[model samples]
Target: MEIKVNDIAVDISGRKVFSNVSFEMKKGEMVAITGPSGCGKTTLLNCLGMIKTVDYGKIMINGKNVTKYKDKEKTKFWHDYATFIYQDYGIIEDASVAYNVTLDKYKMNSDKVQKILKKVGLEGRNNELAIVLSGGEKQRIGIARAIFKNATVIYADEPTASLDVKNRELVIELLRQCAKKGAIVVLATHDERLVNECDRIIDMNQF
Candidate 1:
C-alpha cells in the first residue's frame, strides 16, 4: 500500500494552517510528523486520515486520488482500511478490555481477544474494565483494536503524550512492531525517542 501527498495546503476560517506539504509513505514504513506548536501537525494527520479536507493539491492512495472522495467514500475508506490511535486512548471507559478491542464488531470469543491482547502485553485482561487500567494499558488496548482490524494505514496522534517513560517506550515498540508487520504507521509526536524510532521524518517546519 502507498500514500502520496502532493503540494497540499489547508485553511481554517480564513487562517492558513499549512501549505505546500508533500510526502510519500509505503507499507511497512513508520513516519513521524514533527514541528512546533501551530505548525499543523495534527491538522495534517487529520487530512491524511481523511477526516479533514485540503484546500489545494491532492491526496493519493494506491494511485487513486482520495482527496476528491465524497463523504460516503471517505467513511467507507476509514472503516475498511484505516485506524487511529489517540493520545486520549479513545477507549470506551465503561467497557471491558475485550469489548474495547473488538468494539462488538468482532466476536467476543476468549481465544481471539486473548491472542491480540497478548500481543499488546495485556494478556488475560480481557474481562477487566477499561476504566481501571493504567494510561499505558489503555493505549495498548487501542493498538490491539488496530491489530484486530488489520488496518492498512494507522494514524496515531500524540499517542505517548500521556504515558510515563516505561509505558512510553512500550508504546513506541508496539507501534514499531505494527510497521514491521506491513502497516503504514504515521504519527504526530514531539517526543524525540519516538521520532528517532521512525523510519522517516516529515519535519513540518520545512513546509
Candidate 2:
C-alpha cells in the first residue's frame, strides 16, 4: 500500500492551518509528524486520516486521488483499511478488554481474544474492565485493537504523550512491530525518543 500527498493545504475559518505539504508513505514504514504545538501537526494527521478535508492539492492512496473522496468512500476506506490510536486510549472505558478489542466484530472466543491480547502484553486480562487498567495498559489495548483489525494504515496521535518511560518504550516497540508487519504507521508525537525510532520525519515547522 502507498499514500502520497502532493502540495496539500488546509484552512479553517479563513485561517490557513497548513499548505503545500507533500510526502509519501509506503507499507512497512513508520513516519513521524513533528513540530511545536499549534504548528498543524495534528491537522496534517487528520487530513491524511480523512478526518478533515484539504482545501488544496491532492491525497492519493495507491495512485488514486482520495482528497475528494465521497463520505461513503471515506467511510469504507476507514472501515476496511485504516485505524486510529488516540492518546485517550479510545476504548470503551467501562467495557472489558476483550470487548474493547473485538467489539463484537470478532467472536468472543477465548483463544482468539487471548492471542490478540498476548501480543500487547495483556495476555490474561481479557475479562478485566478497561477502566481498571493503568494508562500504559490502556494504550496497549488500543494497539491490540488495531492489530486485531489487521489494518493497513495506522494513525496514532500522541500515543505516548501520557506514558512513563517504560510504557513509552513498549508502545514504540509495538508500533515498530506493526510497521515491520507491512502496515503504514504514521504518528504525531513530541517525544524525541519516539521520533528517533521512526523511519522518516515530517516536520510541520518546515512547511
Candidate 3:
C-alpha cells in the first residue's frame, strides 16, 4: 500500500502544531519521524493512522482519500490495514499473552502468533499473564502484536524505549523485517541508533 500526505496541517487550541506537512510512504520502506519533544510527531502519526483528521489538506492511502472515508470505512480500514504500537506499550495487564496478541480475533492463526512471539524472543510465554512480565517483556509483546497483525502499515511510537541494547536491536530488526514483507513501517522515535537504520527520516521541526 502507498500513503501520501499532501500539505496536511493540524492545530491545537488555535495554535498551529504543524503546517504543510507532506510525504509519501510505501510498502517495503521504513521512515522515521524525528524531532525535539512536543514537536507534534505523535499528532502526525495520529493523522496518518486515521485516529485523527487533518485540520487542512489531504491524506491518501492506496489511492483512497482517508480524509473523506466514512465512519464505517474508517473502522474497516483500521481493522484490516493499519495497527499502532504506542509509547506506553499498550497491553492488557491481566490478559494472557495470546489474548493480548490476538485480541478478539477468533480466526487468527495460532502458528502466526507463535512466529511473532519467537521474533520478539518471547517464544514459550504465550500462556503467561502480562502483569507478571517486566517492562521490557511487555514492550516486546507490544511489538509482537504489531508484527502479528500484518497490516499494510505499522505506526510505532518510541518502540525501543523499554528495551536494552541487544533487544533494542532485535526489535528494530523485526520492524525492518515487517517492511521487507511489504508493510510500510513508520515510527516516531528519538533513538539515534534506531533512526539511523530507517530508510528515510522526516524531521518534524522542519515542518
Candidate 4:
C-alpha cells in the first residue's frame, strides 16, 4: 500500500493546478491534503487515485508506476486495490443500507452486510433508506462500503464537511483505523481537528 508521488504536475485549460509535487508514504500511514480553496488538494488525490492523470512525473503504488500500467491494468487496480469515499455521500439515496453496502447480493450476503454495518455503528439500520439517514450516518455508510471492499488505499474527500463534533470525530476515527489496519489513507480536508491527527499533512499550497 505504499504510495510515491514524484514531480507530479497537473494543468487545466492551460492553467497549472499544481506542479513539482513529490511525496511518499507507506502502508499504515495517514496523510492529509490541506490548503486554501482551488489549491488542487482534491485534484492531487484524484491523480494519485488514477481518476485523473498527471501532466508530468510518475505515481507509484507498491513500487509499480501506475502511469505506466495499461488502461485495463489501471482500471483493475482502481477497482480492486483502491476505494474512494466521496464527500457527497456516494450512496444510493433510494436504496437500503444493506444494498448500498453490498451493491448486489453476490458481493456480500445479508449476514456479512450486517456485520459490516455493525463495525460502522449502523448495526440495525441495514434496512433503512439512505435518504432517511443523517449526514454523519451517511458518511458512516461510505466508510462501511470502503471497509466492505477492503481496498489497500482509501481516498476520502472532505468526508466530514458538514458534520457535528461527534460525527466528525467518528469519521476521523474510522479513517484512522483504516491506516492502523495497514491501508494507506489519504484525505482532502480543511478541518484542522482532523488534520492534526494525521501522520503527515501535505499542504498543497506549499507548491
Candidate 5:
C-alpha cells in the first residue's frame, strides 16, 4: 500500500514535535527517516503505524483516510497491514524463538516458523528461549516475526542502533530483503550505512 502523511502536526506532553510534516511512500520503496535524536523520526513512524495519534493530519493508505479510524478499527488496520520493529527487540524473553515468531498465529506450523528462522540465519534456534539468544539473534527473531506476517508495510524504529558492526549489517540486509519482496520498508535510523543503502530518504527535520 502507498502511504501519505499530509500536513501532520504532533505534540507530546505539551512539547511540539513534528509540525506540518508530509510525505509520500510508494509500495516496494525503502525509505529512511534520518535526523538527530529527539527530532521526531520515531514519532513520525509511530503515526505511520497508527501506534500514535497526530494532533492534526490525514494519513491516507491506498487512497483511504486511516487517520480517523475508530480505536477498534485502528487495531484491525494494524493487525493485517503494518508491523513495527522496535530497537529494543521486544521478544518475549520466556518464550521459545518459535513461539515468539508465531506470536498469535496459532495455525502456523513448526515447519513454517523454522523455515523463516533459517531465512533470517537463525536456523535450529527455534527451540531456544528468547532471553538465551544474543542481541543479534533476538533481532533476527523480530525479523522472522515480520516476515511470517507478510505485512504490507514494515515500520522500524532505530533497528540497528544497539548492535555492533556485523549485526548492524545483518539487520540492514534483512530489511532490504523485505523491500525486495514488495513490502514498503520505512526505517527511522541514524546509521549512515543503512541510509546509504536505502532506496529513498525522508529527512524528518523538514517537518
Candidate 6:
C-alpha cells in the first residue's frame, strides 16, 4: 500500500504543530522521522496514524482519500490497516501477556497467542502481568500486539528509548521482520543506530 500526505498542516489548540508537510510512504519501506525533541515528529506520527486530523491538506492511504471516510469506516480502517506503538509502551498492567496478545479478540485464540509470544521470544512470559515485565519485555509485548492486529502500517514512537543494548537490538530486529513481511514501518526516533538501518529518513528538521 502507498500512503501519500500532501501539503498537510496541523494545529492543536491554535498552535502550529505541522505545516505544509508532505511525503509519500510506499509499502515495504522503512521511513525514520528524526529530529531533536519538540520538532513535531510525534505529531506527524499521530496525524499519520489518524489520531490527529490535519488542519489543512489531504491524507491519502493506499490511493484513497481517507478524509472521505465516515467515523465508523475510519475506525474500522484504522483497526485493520494501522497499528501504533507509543513512546511509553502502552500495555494493560492488569492483563496477562496472553490476554494482551489476543487484545480481547476471540478469534485470536490461545494457540495463536502462544505462537506469537514465542515468535517474540516471550513464550514463557504469557502468564506474567504486564507490570512485572522488564522495559524490553514490555516493548516486545507492544510489538506482539501490533503483529496480532495484522496491520499493514506500523507506527512506532521511540520504540527503543528505554532498553539495554540487547533488548534494543531485539526491538530493531522485530521491526525489520515486520518490514520484511511487507508492512510500512514508520518510526519516530532519535536513535542514530536505528536511523542508520532505515530504508529512508524523513528528517523533520528539514521542514
lDDT of each residue in 1-207, candidate 2, tens digit only: 999999999999999888899999999999999999999989999999989889999999999899879999999999999999997889898988899987883565558678988888888888888899999999998888889889999999999998999999999999999999999999999999999999999999888
TM-score of each: 0.97, 0.97, 0.94, 0.96, 0.95, 0.94
lDDT of 6 by residue, 1-207 (tens): 899989988778888776878889888888999999998999899888777777888889978888666788778987778888878888888988877777784644567788888898998787778889888998998899888877799999999998999999999999988988999999999999999889999888776
Per-residue lDDT for 1-207 in model 3, tens only?
Answer: 899999999999999999999999877999999999899988999899888889999999989899998889989987897888888889999988888888954633488888788778888888888999877788778767777777778999998886788878887888888889888999999999889989989899989
Which RMSD does model 6 reach against the true structure? 1.5
* lDDT (C-alpha, whole model) for all candidates: 0.92, 0.91, 0.86, 0.89, 0.87, 0.86
Off by over 4 Å in 2: none
Cα displacement (angstroms), candidate 4, residue 96, comes to 1.1
Question: Which model scores highest in lDDT?
Answer: 1
Q: How close is candidate 1 to the true structure, as a TM-score?
A: 0.97
Off by over 4 Å in 6: 105-109
Cα shift from native, residue 135, model 3 (Å): 2.1
RMSD of each: 1.1, 1.1, 1.5, 1.2, 1.4, 1.5
Worst 10 residues of 3 by lDDT: 104-113
If both were scored by TM-score, which would come out higher, candidate 1 or candidate 6?
1
Task: For candidate 4, write residues 107-150 as lDDT tens digits.
Answer: 54567788889888888888788999999999999888878888
In each prediction, how many residue pairs overlap at the backbone (N, C-alpha, C within less than 3 A)?
0, 0, 0, 0, 0, 0
lDDT of 3: 0.86
TM-score quality measure for candidate 2: 0.97
| Between candidates 2 and 6, the lDDT winner | 2
- Our tally of clashes for model 2 stands at 0
Better of 1 and 6 by lDDT: 1
